[model samples]
Target: MKFLLTSGGVTNPSIRSALDGLLDKPVDQCTALCIPTGMYGHPWVGPGVKAWEFVAGKEEGNPMVGLGWRSMGLLELTALPSLPAEGWQPAVRDADVLLFSGGDAVYLSHWVRESGFADLLPELTDTVWLGMSAGSMVTTPRIGQEFVGWQPPGGGDDSTLGLVDFSIFPHLDHPALPTNTLAAAETWATGLGGPAYAIDDDTAIVVTDGGVEVVSEGTWKALAM
Candidate 1:
């Protein structure tokens, strides 16, 4: 699978073109899967999932398809009413492309686990992988700085889908998250001894079978784990 990972949601509309390039295209579009943005809880996810399902001609039944996806907070799922016992994994298995959006990484991880989506996501490596902020962070084997202070507050065990070898300190230096998590990112890099990427909202780190590239408006820093 090819990947278009970003620090935040696709603020620059033009970036969608860049994202399309990652896919094999029209014929192979069935293989695409969009990861749920970990904000607004599942309320936001209803639509993103709906869009793809609509395009795919599935037409199951999930809200948010045309209403414009909300900033679905990952933690929001915890408060949502219970899902069917069959759970989310069934739908996930039937899909191909996975799109991820920015939000709370901690809550997103939990939903994957509790919803049984975690086990179903591994084979997606051959499919298209798209991520925003928290979505991008969860792609790495170990999520970066956000998980450093993780506890009950930061959410525990930042277990991502492991699509990438590195972690990310997303939105670093942004007014919303001004403090740079260099220390935490470096610590993860050193421990894993692989490589980690740090990005701001204006930047994106694109990864493919070939290599990793930086795309966006700003410079990014990477460290070898």
Candidate 2:
């Protein structure tokens, strides 16, 4: 699968162009499946109006589902286990992209495993995994304890899917999130024991065919492990 991982969802023209390249078609021609499961794991974002806004593509800071796609659908991970894989797997295979929203990576990763979605990823070769914030973070090896919030059932480590080789510290230098400064990201990276990136809202990390590239129109840094 190809990846267009971002701190913010297609927040700038550069990132949007990257998305277009990944899709190999216009945004209006591709189909998308929006996964809003991660928002529920976040205390401040889900099971309420925030969740509704995200699904409706009206969330103030996030610009994902609202993008013009041929068709847009929701894939709530929590409901997948109750249904048969045959019922849902086809939809996943048919979609051009999977849009993941920002929230708690740990919770999102848990459901990604529990819901059997992680198992499906290996087969979706042509699909793009478009991730925002925690959505992007979940693709890495670990999110670090600083980003941990909603713990998994019976507990687990800070580890994620490790789809990529490194870690990500998102939302760097945002005025509203003072703790998300570059210095904090650097401090967070030291304990990760692997390569990591600290990226602002205008940045994205693209991974296609095992090649990684940073697509940014804003500040970013690759912290050494």
Candidate 3:
């Protein structure tokens, strides 16, 4: 699967172009599935208005689901375990992209595995996994202790899906999030003990065929693992 991981959603032209490249066609011609399961696990953004805004394309700073597509639908991971694969797997296979909302990466990772979505990763060879904030973080090897929230049921470590080799620090140097500064990201990287990227709202990391590319219109820094 291809990845268009962003600190924020496609908030700029450059990142939008990168997404278009991943799609290999117009955004209007593609189908998308907005996964808001991650939102419920976050303390700051739990299941309610936030989740509704994301699916309804009302998220203030994050511009994901609002993007006009041929069709858009929801794939709540928490509910997947109760249903049969034949009931939903076909929709996943047919979709052109999966839009993951920002929230708790650890929580999202847990449900991804629990709902059997982890097993479907290999089959989504042509699908794009577009992520924002925690959505993007969940794809990495670990999110570090700094971003840990909504811990797993068995009390696991900060480790995530590890779909990507590096970790991510989202919302770097934002006005409201003082702790998300470059200095903080550096400290977080030190604790991670691995390669990582600290990206601002305008930046995104595109991964395809094992190649890593940064698409940015703002600021970012790469910390050595």
- List the global CA lDDT of all models: 0.56, 0.92, 0.93
lDDT of 3 by residue, 85-180 (tens): 998888899999999999999999999999998999999989999999999999999999878878776798899999999999999988889888
Q: Residues 1-225, candidate 2, lDDT per residue (tens digit)?
A: 999999989898999999998997888999999999998999888888988888898967669899988999899999999999998989999999999998899999999999999998999899999999999999999999999998776888899999999999999998889989888999999999999999999999999996999999999999984
TM per prediction: 0.63, 0.98, 0.98
Off by over 4 Å in 1: 26-37, 40-96, 145-159, 181-193
User: Candidate 3: deviation at residue 199, Å?
Assistant: 0.3
Ranking by lDDT: 3, 2, 1
| Per-residue accuracy of model 1 over 76-176 as CA lDDT, tens digit each | 23432376535544444544446665556666766666655556556556565567667677677777544532234545665566767777777666765
Reference-based lDDT, residue 101, model 1: 52
- Using TM-score as the yardstick, the better of models 1 and 2 is 2
